[model samples]
Target: MSVDFEAARLASGTPDELAKATEAAIATARGGIERFKKATGDAAELLDIFDEANAALGNLRELAGMIAKAHPDKAVRDAADEAEQELDKVATDISLDREVYEALAAIDVSGLDAATRHWVAKTLREFRRAGVDRDDATRARVRELQEELVGIGQDFDRNIRSDTRTATLPPSALAGLPDDYVRAHPPGEDGLVRVTTEYPDVIPFLTYATDAGAREQLWRLFQLRGHPDNIEVLDRLIERRHELATLLGYPSWAQYVTENKMIGSADAAGDFIDRIAAVAADRLRADLATLLERKRADDPAATAVDPWDNSFLQDRVKAERFAFDSQAMRPYFEYGRVKAGLMDLTERLFGVSFTRRQDAPVWHPDVEAYDVSRGGELIGRIFLDMHPRADKYNHAAMFTMVNGKAGVRIPECALLCNLPQPGDDPALLQHDEVSTFFHEFGHLVHHIFAGHTRWSGMGGISTEWDFVEAPSQLLEEWTLDAPTLATFAVHYKTGEPIPAQMVEKLRAAEEFGKGIFVRQQMFYAAVSLELYRRDPQTFDVAELKRELQARYAPFPEVPGTWFHLSFGHLDGYSAIYYTYMWSLVIAKDLFTVFKREGLLDEETAARYRDAVLAPGGSAPAAELVRKFLGRDYTFDAYQAWLNS
Candidate 1:
């Protein structure tokens, strides 16, 4: 039977309806667990029952979390949050159940296919990690820690989403911003302009606004989000994670989390961070010198660039040195055109088609839905929640609604982003926003294409945690390709294709900020890793953050601003923020084949889809890369790109 996108419980609009649906799902999952405990059947049959139960619970958890993050009504969001907490408690119980673990372990998997064998082995190992074999007291404590971690995580996210600080300034503060941006934010009756900490407001203001004091004010407000409250929340989070890790026989949460990932250990992740930092040190010095030089042109006494000045200076340098003004590209990136052009580009490259489903149920009016198909066979569904709303998630990500299991269910996902909303004026986007759209779409397509795995656990983008970002990062390269940009990058008014010279200049200008950009990423990665590696009770997070910022970044840390309080990844990604760079290294290597052939080459694209993305987590991530490259991936491509 085909999946009914509208029938999904996440579409429920009222809090009561959603709450009842969640309860029903929980009851059904519990019933399935009971069946699993008493079933007498072959290994395959028993495993199917186990996977089916888990898949149902997993899907409900994902949907509830999405609603918690994106739903418009406060009551519904609250209900979703409650549903998620309940679902997590059930999941934790299942993971710690001895009868379920022993039943699965006794199954004879020797005669099964490689994928099934892999699924069984990995499940058993995870069971062990859950402390299923421990004494009753230890197991009970593990469950408590896991459940508490969920609430702590939700609190961290809630504080950031709820606190949107705004800076009110005179009209002159809008001088260096684009005409469209100024039009979008006209002054109030008080004749003062206001900008919020949201991305749609803060990013452009930071990159273009000429008022140094105003920029610093906004930057400080942005950094101070979730402060004071999240400070204590984060401390509790780290302490609980450390306690959980020690209970599981690991020294720290970093070691516990990384043991299953491609990087393999906390020390290995740390070394990788240091290695990348060392390679970029020379470039960091050079980049900072340029920024300081440009700053001196305005303020002769200035010796260092402040955090607020980084973006403005980088944009200035790019325009002056490469003859590329990012503002010029904005007119061509009207939200509607960019959306259509992206779908068209993917259709040509991946041999898939997207048909808009206007009648599909959505949580908000701004969201658009589409059905994906290949050779006329419907494969998946996607929803684009591209614009921001109050109390919504403040970042871009792909959230899964349904995990595709062959012959059982089709994949469903959504892209939740906070780009500019179009109303009276054309909603033009910054070049980097265009890149972000492509990057998130890359994740959507990867999930759809890989969703057909035989086992539920192996379906969708379930690759090693550290390697999951590669395919999406690799797609960002397409945005910079001249031919690719020309396909959709036409001016909204004149309908003129973006000038080739402009594209050339943009690419050249993009290279100028590599060193500083990379080092900034390293600083974030170090903060994530070291925070989890240290003893939560003794170490001062602020001191550790200040030291890492100075060690890895060009700009000095702003005093009295606690950015770590708002670092959301510390909850979700925990110790693996290093995955972004690690995945980029592999992404650069994967792009080589396309560079050698052509960006739009169908044969090459098909091969890449089959080798790298199709297997999902059915195989180790390293093996997938080796299959595509005919050898192991290396940092050569990454280093060369960094230097270029």
Candidate 2:
């Protein structure tokens, strides 16, 4: 079970070595500033300076922080944590540098290419936002606020990471859960099954467990994650963020966060969600009505379906109404085969190939490395870490260590997921789990294929956070498509493809609970927005959540649950949980092109890669979308998705 942290140890050198690297990066950026002052006469020379700054401030810092957060060894994580502070200091210094700002702003960008002009514009805007153009006193305050935010955010994340909550239930309490799950999780000396809130445990029990009381117990425990400690951390963070936003001339932190996003403003994001809800209310009502009816059938005296009953009830409904459900699809989706099939499909769709490298050095034995290639030439390397472990980051995400640049060195990234571990049988993924695999893999492909920027700053997943999720969301549609699923969903035991009837049922059941789904997303987005707009001095997050939930959601607020405390997104995502829905709107639209062109159309895929993925963040996101779609992005796709 032990992992070798040798890679992290090497990448995260000793404290002195880390400080030296930070100083070196700063020195290099300083030299770049001088280069820019001298070379303002030519666009190419100015771009050279900007690229050097990106390497020093962007690439180096990004790499260091990634190791600090994800490296398995405690010693490596601590060392990397120290390096992250040094990296952040160097970055903060560059962002607030008046000399760099002046040099960049003075450049003649009129004759420069589109990408170069955009780079210059973005660089200037960042400097201004960081208060480099402000008075000396204001700039000092800005620096102080930024540093405080770094510490607060780190503490909040640490509390969530260290939170250890478990539910101990008797063998009979786990009745409806999969047999493999029972075998994998043995009872302790006290003779009870210990269930942790990791996705692998929580999701299955919520979906399949027959004991309603046990479900409620687990749900309540899960909701209290990061509580008592993170609540105070979050309150302080809100205050600091509000101060920073007002300092930057924004009315609220929400406006500050959304100003540069595709959504343009917080009000617009709120209105967008509200509009979707208006259209979806009917669907939401119907979904809940169906669940309530099923609940009554089970217990006629039951007044209402509890929050914990949704997943369990939905699974039963799907089985009876659609003739299939997540568990039924598991055999065709054994994790290893699903991954291999994903690689095969990528080869056909994108003209790229991935070959596994067993000898590669990885942080954990569970991690698998691959070389992404095109026609036998290396394009990038991806490390996949897709199993659960103690203290591992529980969510599914892609972590990029190096950005890929065409004609330069290949990029390096790792895909992290806390999926079910192999038991007596190989791990069989639920259909949704398979969808997640494709989703995270989409990000890896985007980072690798899209690494064509002069600035590593804008390479890989460096696009606007709102826009970054689009590529991955678009990929999720592929996993749902019957033809695409056919490429992977073969039974692990029988070696037979998933039955046509089952695939049809899966597709048919897609709309069963979408209304409730949309409403929940709306409530989350609204909460994030209101959090920033309210006065943190006496802001009642619990009250705001209750109001938002009652207004936007179909279900009433549950008593005694502090859901926001467990919301990890509050620290990282903040006023942008709305981005998920926002990006999905665009994602659904993007998939339409593939739908029309044929999902496996090699020529269209080639064009898409070159236009959307290859340019990376060199072009504006809107411009990239325009090129790929031959028109402006629209909400029609989302409306269609909702109506379906």
Candidate 3:
């Protein structure tokens, strides 16, 4: 018998179409839940029914959530917002459904395969975590809390997305920016240049702009995103999260959120932060002294380097001390060529090929879709939405469109980012942007390679939440490799490859900021953990942020800025922003094997894909690492990398 597999379709057309699609998906899920409640026969049969119900619900939620964040039309976004709330209600009902829980709990899993068994156990744990076993009144309140959280989180994110603040400055403020950036932002009829808080604008401006006054102006405005509004919204979010955790018997939301993670508990997460901070302290002090010395070159009375000065000063240090000017490489990293290079690089490494899928549906015109194949067989699909626009998601992330199920469905995902858009002038990217592209694409390929699985729940990037970033972080190492850049990093006009000497300088220059970078990350991680660990009602969020910033970071908090209000992770990652650093520890260790072998060696890449990415969430993250490395991961590699 010949079989066909269909890729997941993105919701398109009018706001009404999006609404109908959402309703239809929810209805299908509800029907699946009904069948699940009636399932019989054996453990496998009941599990199949359960997966079927969740697969529909999961796909629905992913679709609606992506639309809410990425869709172009305000009407469609609003419609998606409503659809998310409705879907959350259905999800809460499923989580609290005692009949479905009992059905799964009664299954005889001894005869099932290990993956299915693990899924069953994990599902039961989630059910309990959702308060499914509680009394009717408690479960009802749990449902209310979960439902309210959906809207609250949406409100928090919406405020940040919609609140794109701008600073109006004269053309002279563009003195230190790349020529391409200057051309793109020519003064308007008012003869004033405008810059926004979007990454494409803010990052380059901060790193290259010579006008300290303009940089400070833009920096403060960037920090003020979602202020006043998100202050109350975030407070409400924290308060309600604590209430939900306490209702479920957790001491605090931090403890509740971290219980299932690799770190084990809130205390462990805190200790890990402190350990990393301690490791970064000496480097932080040295880096601070270096920046201050450079600052004093221009201003003799300078005592401390301001936060707005860090990037520009670092760029100067790279040029002066390391003989590398970041702008010199921008012409070689034009956005279009960078995308092509990344795709070409990954294809060669992983033994897969990508062919454009012109007929595929996408929510935006800017999105480009491709079919991922191996050995001439279609395996999965991916979409790239790689530019900024008003009201779009303002960060880089991989959003799942569909989870792969072996012999049943093919995986699909999209990379939503705010990179420079190609227009009349070529979109030149800084080296850091290139690394970010590689990092997020790491998540995409992981989703594709590990996609094929027996169950949706254990498919794609479904590993422990804390370990999810490891694969992506590991891929970033490839960006700094000279051999890898030779394959695609060519000047846009001349078509000449990036010079090996320049790549060496780029690598050397990157090391200068490692200490300060890690400490700053620690500061964010501290804020993420402490906010939930403490009593939200009693502590002032801004004051707590100031204290944490002082302890972990070298720079003092600016007087009027309230960074916690705009810290988007508080809503999504919540108590686990430390995952980035935690995952990096694992990623750095994983890189040791590749560093020893040739970076372009297909044998090593294939081994990693099979041992690490192919397992998905079927086994514990540590087990997956051991399978690849023949030993457990360690922080020794991370410490060496940090201190090197």
Best by TM-score: 1
> Where's the lowest-lDDT run of ten residues in candidate 1?
1-10
lDDT of every model, 2 decimals? 0.90, 0.79, 0.90
Candidate 1 lDDT by residue in tens digits, 471-501: 9999999989989989999999999999989
Choose 1 or 3, whichever is better by lDDT.
Answer: 1
1-644 per-residue lDDT for model 3 (tens digits): 11122323445556787677778878888898898788778667677778877888787688778778888889988998898898889989999999989988888998878877777888899999999999999999999999999999999999999999999999999999988889988999999999989999999999999999999999999989998999889989999999999999998999999999899999999999999999999899999899999999999899999999999999999999999989998998989888998999889889999999788777789999898999998888888999999999999999887888887778888899999998989889999999999999999999998878888889999889999999999999988999899888999999999999999999999899888999999999999999999778889888889889989976889989877888899999999999999999999999999999888889999999999998899888999999999999988999999899
Relative to the unseen true structure, what is the Cα RMSD of model 3?
1.5
- By TM-score, the better pick of 2 and 3 is 3
| Stretches of candidate 3 exceeding 4 Å from the true structure | 1-10
> Whole-model lDDT, candidate 2?
0.79
The number of clashing residue pairs in model 2 is 0
Best by lDDT: 1
lDDT score, candidate 1, position 213 = 94
lDDT of 1: 0.90
For each candidate in turn, the TM-score is: 0.99, 0.95, 0.98
Query: Backbone clashes per model, in order?
Result: 0, 0, 0
